[model samples]
Target: MGDLNAKVGREYDGFQGTIGKFGIGVRNDNRRRLLELCGASGLSITNTYFNHKLEHKTTWVSPNGLVQNLIDYVIVNQKWKKSILDTRTFRGCRRVPSDHKLVISKIRIKIQANQEKRRTIKFDVDNLRNERVKQQYEVKVGGKFAALIGMENMDMDSEESWAILSSDTKDVATEVLGYKRINSKPWFSDEAKVLSEEQQRLRVQVDDKQDLEKKQQLKRRRNRKLRELSDRMKHDQNMFWKERATKVAVAMEIGESRAMFAAVRFLRNASQEKVWRGVHGMLDEDGNLVTDEMEKRNLFARYFERLLNVDTTRYWDKKKKKSIADLNEALEVQEEDISAKR
Candidate 1:
């Protein structure tokens, strides 16, 4: 999970369960400590379990590029050891400027169903402005109310009467007004979308190209497409905002508060949507990107559980307790001597 700077080497020996035979280099003091920790905690060094090329196995390299070492590791509990599908270093990554390669692990775990979100019911009450729909709703509700009046002698409770009225009203509204459908328009136009797709295609081509000349050519094309896509997006965004501003201005000029507020709400929701999409997923403790909703929820739950329920037994052991007691006794003697002098 981190760069522990431990050279475990290829020896498993007594630490068979904790260390794997695929490790590189010779064991060191740090390696011994790491092995001991893993053995005591019932964890397995996942990086050493999978066999890969030497380039993929090495995590850190010397500045002179003469030496390479596997210092970073991904450790997991023995119970979930089988979940580690693959673990290796990605040397092709250029996002970070460091001698250490990006260590990544592919893990597969069972995901439980997330709780269904509650949906708010919204009727198209604006449709009631239509005379025909309003008349139909009124007629249906009036007929139901008349029927309920005929049952006045049946000795119904106040709760029963209210429930019947509420049900009838909802049924009438459902049949007449119907539900509102929310459809959000995208800010980018079709041409921008095409350019974006082209840029992505070129990017994939660039990554897959092994020939230096071809790869450089593809990268240049990708960059060109990227710039074009960016310009198109900016233009579309500006047009979208201008249109929204015009709509809001017109609504205000007409003194239509509902239209003005609706435009404002749309802008707010669009911004919120962009923010939500940007942060739809997050990196886990292992620096792995997690996108599954259930996994994200579980990660947050575990984080808070650990944060609120900290175990201080390791720091407040018998040795530390005795040391603190001795310090307190010395302080008390010094205080007694000072008081006697006073």
Candidate 2:
């Protein structure tokens, strides 16, 4: 839940399934948009569905205390509408000092655990670049193959023979090159974390203080701590990126294409993972939500199969023929020029 600032008032006329009659304030353009989005996505505004007091419903207030609106909301899928027990705003929370009150929702869900665990085996293949490791691996693998060849007289099927070969190769590789080690480092330093905690403490103190002067003083210190924390985070982030860039540059300079590409791919996959985390599921042709991984893969495969096999023969008319002829003519001329230069 967040400060959406969309005043979805108590009008449930056409959006009966998306909103409820208990919402506060007058409806605005943003409210209409939010309603339409929720309706289309099969989501319900949990904050509006539950009945609560005015103080518990309103999430934001003006500085002069003249205007109060229920702008923040907790939205959930209509399929899980019964799972959300309650939704309301907590105005008495002094831990965070903000004009917007804390909007929270209590949800009950049962998660099933997978019984089978899939483990991927990764070898230190990068070490194979070393001459000593390469020679050792080759010798071990060659000896295993020789032993397998000596077992040719046995009554073994093709599958068993193939399995034996594969197992022996893996055993040799494991003995020669070890497993790859993964090392993860945090981005922020201890100083930044300390400053963040101090800022939070000051905020709570400012909210609890009775005297205006003391509250103002606490607020100033909190703001200073916030600035310091922000600067420290920026410094840490820059240093992290700087180190990554240095590794990429060194790999490129040394002609290590594998290492350079691996670094680039890691950065790309990290960004893709961050973007994919927000995507919950996809809708099928019947407008039903598909959450299963295998089903989603099948849906994508079917969609692309139909899209890529479209009948485009009608578009291959005189203009396309002329374009192809021109391209071939240019290629012939280039081939002739190359021959002349040679």
Candidate 3:
């Protein structure tokens, strides 16, 4: 279920193996099949899937066109009663580095208190708060994975994580969406191309006028040079990302080689090669990294330090913004206090 789109920005929806919004018909069939398997009742499978809540507020495509509505189709239709050990199943995002956002829930079924604990319907609430906002605030899936309303996360690592990981948990991408293949980069439309072209032409004209007298001087070549520099920086950043991928591969024990990380690593390297002199270089009289920039750099460094150690919690709050973890933490604390008083 590969795809081609003019729109791109890491917003994949639905499961793996599904074609997403682009493959409506294909997804329809998959949805139907799922319906049969689950025997879901009259529910709106169409117009389901929610858009991810990120800075871009990008709507995700349903990979296989799977009946995202059918995710918890059976349970919801039947109105099955259940108890989740971890109420966090319905929780959403934690703002990780993944291109697409992911939602998580524990769906074990719960019975009467005296009944034997069934490991049927639950899992821990692994998703942070931002993810929950994305999930709960999704476009009218018309109540899709919502069937999870009455389920539970059975206390057990009984099988594996809901989203399976490689041998090492590091490379653990959620396999639930059923994406059939790796997503390709999206291209801009004709309109976008024309705009980019016009911008380029204007930039060239600006350069010609500004540097007409001293065009030959390196410093006078600012605009033209900026373009060249940006391309290089982009390349380097991509390479850096690739290099990071290898670390994930290594942790996952998936044998992801250095070669695999080459492209992103190159981009990272290019981005790092900035030639800022003067104030841009942050020199106090002596030309050193500036105080503010240095602080920002330090923050970035410390942030990564925590991230590298998988201190996901700390890495998040440093944003000083609202997030799933923070919400959940507050929720938990609130509950604990209530319990203590009782």
TM-score of each: 0.37, 0.34, 0.18
Task: Give lDDT tens digits, candidate 2, residues 1-342.
Answer: 677879988778888778888988888879878888899999999998889999999988888888899988888889898999999988889587688888888989978887897878799998999999999999999999999999999999999999999999889878999898653434567888899899999989998999999999999999999999977776665455556666787999999999899878865665544223422456788976565457778999999999999988777787799899999999999999999999
Top TM-score prediction, candidate number: 1
For candidate 1, the C-alpha RMSD (Å) to the true structure equals: 23.2
Better structure of 1 and 3 per lDDT? 1
Number of residue pairs clashing in candidate 3, backbone atoms closer than 3 angstroms, sequence gap of 3 or more or interchain: 60
The TM-score between candidate 1 and the true structure equals: 0.37
Give per-residue lDDT, candidate 3, residue 78. 31
Model 3 lDDT, full chain set:
0.38
Candidate 1 clashing pairs? 1-73
RMSD of 2: 24.5
The segments of candidate 3 whose C-alpha lies over 4 angstroms from its true place after superposition are 1-130, 137-139, 142-202, 206-219, 222-231, 234-238, 247-251, 254-342
Per-residue lDDT for 274-337 in model 1, tens only?
5234223466899765555567789999899999999878877977989999999999999999
Stretches of candidate 2 exceeding 4 Å from the true structure: 114-342
lDDT of 3 by residue, 40-88 (tens): 3422221123333232222232556332221221123233223212211
